[model samples]
Target chain A: MPAGTLYRGREGMWSWVAHRVTGVLIFFFLFVHVLDTALVRVSPEAYDEVVATYKTPIVALLEYGLVAAILFHALNGLRVIAVDFWSKGPRYQKQMLWTVVGIWVVLMAGSLYPVLGHAARELFGS
Target chain B: MSSDTTSATIGPVEGAQYDADNPAPYIEAPRKRTGKTPRATRGNFEMAAWLFMRLSGVVLVVLVLGHLLIQLFLDGGVSKIGFAFVAGRWASPFWQVWDLLMLWLAMLHGANGLRTVINDYAERANTRLWLKGLLYTATVFTILLGTLVIFTFDPNIR
Candidate 1:
């Protein structure tokens, strides 16, 4: 009941919160993605145009956000599964949370390499 | 209620022989004191949710795997999965239903799982409210849009 109590408000809880948030975001994105892909049936040109929109700066940034969401959701889900199933996992919950956060940062950075590289090249002559 | 009188009236008895063969009768405790009563004994909501998770999870496994197989492996693999291929697949009622089932199952399963996670984790009352609000919003939006697309997809353009 007191403020700032350890495990009163903990790391695992925040990880679970992020998981649900990301899962919902990814689910919504999936619907849009599936429908957009389905549009290929109507017209090839339309499909191409729709896909071309993804290449825009804003869309690319959104894609990066999606990638981060997916990574966090997946890694945290694994952490949840581990915690639920393993008896001794509670001891390592904070460790696992930090590990997930670290992995997400690394993966996101790696994934952004091409996008960032291209942006740099476009802005500054390479 | 006089606490001193109650204690004085009940003193500890001396040298009671333990009878291994004849045990004392076990009296049922009051319902409120026991705290073991089922919260929703009259309803089937919990049972239905449990069943839904298993059924939806089974269906999701198939739907997701089948989706991946078709999109990633069949025909010329990923390269052939262009606009025309997607349109061709959506042309059939079978594929539409397949997609619809996949959409519904995955959404519901994911939502239910997240609900469980939220209940297990979110401590603050306001935090839970805001998180669930966002979750329900996203889930409803996705499900509605997906259903609309499945039913209203048109293969032809003027």
Candidate 2:
């Protein structure tokens, strides 16, 4: 409970946190997604109109945010594998942390490039 | 001059004679002693995994929060998300890659975390093996399927 002290316990603690978080996100998103699809069943015209509204800049931003979540979850998972299987990896714990960060950064950058690029191009003719 | 033959056999026992004025042999012990000590060093893998959980937890806070704000708060909320909504988002390579990244990260993180849980709790060797096997199978399947959905999504699918 003291400041600057890290809590250490069982191995699955982080994974449990991640699993719960990702599960909630995925579940919530899937629910909304499925409901929106069902709108098509109610009335295709309304669904088409509603879907069209998602092209706004705000929605685009949210899409990018989702990308960040998924990337973190996946990369951290790989870190878990290395720790669980590899023998000499214990020494490289710090290195693995940095690698996860690096991967997240690279993936986010790559994912955001096209949308931001297009937005920039439209805003400023080139 | 020593009566002991075994002591003299190995080497010249210079300090074999322990007199009041003279000291005993300051035998130099071998530098590298190869034998299992009672207290073995803790497994390095477990130490690394412990470190990983803390680090990953901190990062997950940001990722999860940002995801929530966007999906559940921004714009008209969850009501706006749809197939065409996804299609429109993915039409641009940015969202495609974004979804792809999210899919991969969450699956790997969740899967690995689960794997640790299985290893720690499963009593029998077979139980641990089997639980992990199922976990890995599900994780791999979900990840691959999600990735495929992200990339191969046809906006025109009816």
Candidate 3:
């Protein structure tokens, strides 16, 4: 709310915001995931029927987004630990955040084929 | 040891509240600690929770990423996943333990994280309480359900 607050406009704040958003997203997904997986106890047919939805092109895209969220959260979480514990972490926090972003970009790019390849194949032609 | 002697260099300081011989009265400090306040009541639970976040986080980075790789990135990705795939994986004791540990750690970690968020943003006292109550309930239910599913899973239940 305050104008030009250090945390409000800076990398530290944005990374923290991203972390919370991604963490919440992942947490909710975990609930649904557990319930969905629990269907295996119901019946193989019932389980497969539900899992079929996950294989759809739309759901595959969502899965890609899920991967993005998870990767960011994991990487940034480590950065947060460094800022808390490392003796010189505060001095280099900005650099570490940029580093996290860099690795995230690379990993996200790499994941496209593996995570979205099936959907791409399905949407287009294998 | 030489309290009885006072030299000019060690003269009584300006507005000195008390000297060693005239000890101050025991006024209850603002954040008083007393024998009545048991250690268990004020233990480092929050500190433990904070430590758990970092520790479990380090482990989860491995467990969860590996899980994502296997489930969503390998062997044709989600297209290859189905009841049979899950059954095949769960058939092994190693995978079972991996999943069990992941389930417990991830659930607790997330629940605690959400608790922090709720405490930070929820304005009303009742709102925070309700949100946390719901969070804890869901966490417990999900963890127990996942655990039961893992242990009681019958691959032959086709």
Best by lDDT: 3
- DockQ for all models, in order? 0.13, 0.06, 0.66
Off by over 4 Å in 1: A1-7, A114-126, B1-105, B113-158
Worst 10 residues of 1 chain A by lDDT: A113-122
Ranking by lDDT, best first? 3, 1, 2
lDDT of 3 by residue, B1-158 (tens): 46545454565653357753334555677867788877777679999999999999999999999999999998998988988899899989999999999999999999999999999889899999999999999999999999999999998985
Go through the candidates in order and give each one's C-alpha lDDT. 0.68, 0.59, 0.91
Cα lDDT for residue B43, model 2? 57
- In model 3, the runs with Cα more than 4 Å from the true position are A1-6, B1-41
Better of 1 and 3 by TM-score: 3
Candidate 1 residue A27 C-alpha distance from true site, Å: 3.3
lDDT of 1 at B52: 83
Give the range where candidate 1 chain B is weakest over 10 consecutive residues by summed lDDT: B14-23
lDDT of 2 by residue, B1-158 (tens): 57677566766566356653244666677653457644446557767666665555445546655655555445545545565555676689976665566555555655666676677568899999888888777667666666666666666656
The regions of model 2 sitting more than 4 angstroms off are: A1-126, B1-62
